[model samples]
Target: MPFVIILVVLTVPAAIFFCWYQMLVRKYKNSSFIMVYHKVDRYRGGLKGLCVSPEAFDRQMDYLYRRGYRAIPLGSLVDSIINKKDILPKTFVLTFDDGYENNYVNVLPVLKKYGWTATVFLNAGAIGQTVQYPMQPPEKHLTAEQIKEMSGRFDFEPHGITHRALTGLSDDEIREEAEGSKKVVEQLTGKDADIFCYPFGEYNGRVINLLKEAGYRASCTTLPGIVRQDADAYQLPRFEFKETKVWSPRYFFRNFDFYLRTFFAI
Candidate 1:
């Protein structure tokens, strides 16, 4: 009887895990993935994982193209969600965070080669300056001139005036980050900055309300999951594509299988 009891305890949890895995698999299969990239350069001595080499970026784009994956702008995805329109299978939205100058130097050429577009979230305060975060080198973030030059190909949005977490700030501070960044981006690009990316993907209900009050149409988060029709426009999740997943064929398949198993497992 004791042996039977132990067996039941183990089996019950395993059964529950199995059911949850299956639900994730179904969700993944039906949803669209939004991929976020940071830097595309060959010299990521310390920031290896966050930076993808130019060659890897080109290869990944080629793979997506060869597989017939459609890369659409984030705004189109938002429109479909707002209007309750169906998102096609294999649809993806490419996003770049931090507005690194390499985005202009290395990323732009690859994107142009594929005739694709991407949305870049800029640190409004860091424009034309070499901003260094912990463990990251002093790298040149995008300048206004460079931004204007590529304005035709990429959509620029606010990533905050100072790249600080929104949840940790005062109400007025939150407003400054959201509204201030929006104004800066608009002045630079001659377009309304409707979308806001939470700096470091940190936000609370208050931050969301502040963004709404500041006239933001939507926001993106660092949460990892496929974007569904019922997803919150203010808290949309994105998949961060790393070099390991993009550069290795075996690793890519293994990771893809894991994503399916972990997200869609039912």
Candidate 2:
């Protein structure tokens, strides 16, 4: 009797939540959100909380597709907003920071299956080389050749040259890290890198100006919120799945709360 009572309590809320989500799936069918990700590897390394296993990533992609969620480029989303155009609903901006080699080796194929593309904010300094860390194993970054190869499925944007916080740098130093990396990616991709993300999600007024001077159209921050029509382009907010339990009821509650406040003015 105790177990049955507990099950009833749980199932009731779950059923309500499921129905709510299905309704939202239709109501917000034309809305957009930016989703953050890092490595898509089976790597079980320490300090890899941000990494998603390939199998899990594949499953997540499948879930998103079935839910009517689709991926769009960051530039395209920003352009639509800037041009006063309506965004395609059920769309999200797929963004990966640090531009890990696993993106090419792992993430690309999964995205290809879904007919989705991603935007990778590259650590411009380590382009075409291995990324070395103080107390961690060396990880290779996306090389120029590999970047070119996957150009069809990826939009490589500038993160920074050294992956440092731009708020701590002087104007000239910021330019070098900002504009310099922009130049590198432009030359490699042969397309103007308009949208970028703040390294470590750090930026300030000075950093914003430096980025504008470098000709960036917008910047994505780690700030947790939905992207709306009136969102500040410089301080654009993004959200990430902090755990592997993608689409669980827990996340549904989290997103539902945010959706109420953002869309319904809770």
Error of 1 at 86 (Å): 1.8
Task: Give the per-residue lDDT digits (tens) of candidate 2, residues 66-94.
Answer: 76678888888888777767777667788
**Model 1: residues with Cα > 4 Å off, grouped in runs:** 1-30, 244-266
For residue 110, model 2's alpha carbon misses the true position, in angstroms, by 0.8
Tens-digit per-residue lDDT, 106-223, candidate 1: 9888778878888999999999999888788788899899999998779999999999999999999999998999999999999989999998889989999999999998999987
Per-prediction TM-score to the true structure, in the order listed: 0.82, 0.82
**Best of the candidates, lDDT:** 1
Question: What pairs collide in candidate 1?
Answer: 21-265, 22-265, 22-266, 24-263, 24-264, 25-263, 25-264, 25-265, 26-264
Counted clashes in each candidate structure: 9, 2
RMSD of each: 7.0, 6.2
Error of 2 at 9 (Å): 18
Residue 38, candidate 1: how far off, in angstroms?
0.7
